[model samples]
Target: MILCCGEALVDMIPVDLPAGGKAYAPHAGGAVFNTAIALGRLGVETGMVSGVSTDTFGRMLASQLEENGVSTAYLARSGRLTTLALVHIENGGATYSFYDENSAGRSLTFADMPALGDEVSALYFGGISLVAEPAADAYASLLAKERANRVVMIDPNIRPGFISAEHTYRDRLDRMIGQSDIIKVSDEDLDWLIEGEETIEIKAAAMRGRGPAIVVVTKGAEGATAFFGDASVGVAAPVTHVVDTVGAGDTFNAGFLAGLNDKGCLSKDALGSVSDDVIHHALSLGATVAAVTVSRAGANPPWASEINR
Candidate 1:
């Protein structure tokens, strides 16, 4: 099983109401949460580790995870309110305004982290939870403790707006990256992390030097590239009718991880020794999944059946 650790919250998406004015509709989402859901739908054995509320929205999040075949055994239940992200769509893209102060997902502490079982082969972390409060520290603690035993993959999913203290956030993220087996970043995230000092390939090479055996830089519409050892491989994005790019990246992470898992290349050793063919296959699967996600509305991902078809 692959365990995803981070925030679980509600996304208030804008909808065109029949009454003329727009209304916001709630959707269970969060970067890590969406990735877990996508993994489950793709028939990967998955579970979630995060502080979740017992409130309506939290229950909805939990129920959605269960319905999608993700194990909730690692979730820390709280009476605290759930986090809310108001998503504004413009030009087929989405931006977020978060209201997370004192929320269940943001209130997690180190003590709230669950013990991982032997069934878990990999642990995935990232998103707003990595920058949010006590929860961020809690996740960092868990990552440190589990890195030795499981394959670790992290996607910072850098949201410039959510960061309050740049230095602290960078320190935490850097530590996590050092301990991770694979690190996935977007073109924008790479620019933010490296400050455009070098080419994307060069930046990814620097990141690989930190510790991760593989570094993946994703380019929206242009597909993704994987850097390992002294070589890199690129895959072009699949053709699809774009609706919105809400969870496209998150689903891509799921697909990439799932592809690795399917190929029995999820372990740190296996990933370090992976071949170009495996890298190409993984990136292709990720692009296919992202295509399926962008061709739909919201963060909806395709099921294993759809992918198989």
Candidate 2:
């Protein structure tokens, strides 16, 4: 089983105002949660570990997870209010304004961590969970403890607005990047984090030096590039009329993880030598899953049958 650890929150998306009043629609989101569901839907044995409120929204999120075949046994319920992200769409693309500080999901700590055994083959974590306090420390500790146990994949999924530039997050992020066996980043994230970095190879080389055995940088619409030690490969993203890119990248991680696990390349050393054919196959699966996600609204993805895998 692949374990995804992080936030599970509600994304309230804006809709056109009616009579000078704005309206919003609630959707289940949070990068880790979305990836967990997409992985489960792809027939990957997956589970989620995080905090959720006992409130209505939390119940709905849990239901959504179970419905999609993701186990929520490790989900902790609290009386605190569920975290919310206000999603704004412009020109057919989406951006999010978070409301997670001190929210229920942010309250998760090391005490709440579940015992991960040999049943778990890989561990996935990222997003704002790496920025906050006791939770952040706890997650970092968990990653450190598991570094020698399984395939560790990290996707920063950075949102500048949600993080404090003065809080030493960069140092922490750099350390986490080193601890990760696989690291995925977006073009925007790279620009924000790397500063004026041009070539994917340059960025990947810099990131690989930090620790990740394999580094993947995604270019929305254009495609993605991958790096493993001295080797590199680039694959063009599949074309599709994107509906909303909410869970596209998260599902891309899920698909790539699933494909790697299926191909028995979950180890850092194994991924470091992945062939171009394997890389493209993995990217195709990732893009396919993400394509299905973008075709629909929210973080929902295609079921296993739809892909006929």
Candidate 3:
């Protein structure tokens, strides 16, 4: 089973009513939450680990997970309010304004993280949870503690607005990156992390030096490239209708991991010997699923039955 550790919160997406101005619609979202949902819908045995609130929005979040076949077993409850992201979309590109201070997911501490059972073979972490205080440190601690024998994947899913203390967050994130076996980053994220005149390949290689065996870099609407040692594989994005790209990257993460898991390349040792052919297959699967996700509104990922690939 894969355990996704990070934020689970509400996304207030705008909906235009026929009668008047736009109103916000609550959607169960958060980078890790979306990936967990995508994995579950793809028929992967997955569970979410986060500090969920008992409030109405929080209950909605949990219910959505169960509805999508994602396990809520690892969630810890609190009386705190749930976090909310007010989304703004311009020509299908999305940005967020978060309201998360003192919220359940944001206030989580190390003590709130659940003990991992042997059933969990892989762990995934990223997003605002990695930028938010206390929770960031807690998740970094979990990564440091339990990554010994398990395959670990991380995507920073950087949102600059969520960051408070840059140095502290970078230190914690660097630690997690070092412990992770697989690292995924958007082209924008890569540019931000490693600013230079060097080629993208060079920067991605730099990320590999930080410790991950495989580095995946995504360029929205263009394609994605995966660097394994000195070899690299690229996959083109499937053409699809435009919709908000809310959970596209998160879903891609799930699809890629699911493909790796299916091929028995989900172990830290297996990754060392995994072939480029296997990585190509995984990248195609990821692109296929992400295409489906971006074709729809919000963070909804297609079920395995819906996929023809």
Candidate with top lDDT is 1
TM-score of each: 0.98, 0.94, 0.98
**lDDT of the candidates, in the order given:** 0.94, 0.84, 0.92
Write candidate 1's Cα lDDT for 12-127 as tens digits.
Answer: 99999897999999999999999999999999999999899999999999999999999999999999999999999999999999999999999999998887899999999999
- Model 2 TM-score on a 0 to 1 scale: 0.94
Better of 1 and 3 by lDDT: 1
Query: How many backbone clashes are present in model 3?
Result: 0
In the range 226-271, model 3's lDDT, one tens digit per residue, is 9997799999999999687989999999999998988989998899
Better of 1 and 2 by TM-score: 1
Root mean square deviation (Cα) for candidate 2:
1.7
> How many residue pairs clash per model?
0, 0, 0
lDDT of 2 by residue, 1-309 (tens): 899989899999877686886799998889999999989999999999888999999999999999999998878788888889899887768788888777778988888888887788788998888888767777888888888878899998998877775357887778778888889999888777787747767877887888888888899888888888577777787778778888899999998888787787877667767777777677778888888889888788888888844
- Assess candidate 3 and give its lDDT: 0.92
lDDT for predicted candidate 2 compared with the true structure: 0.84
**Which pairs of residues collide in candidate 1?**
none
What's the true lDDT of residue 242 in model 2?
A: 78
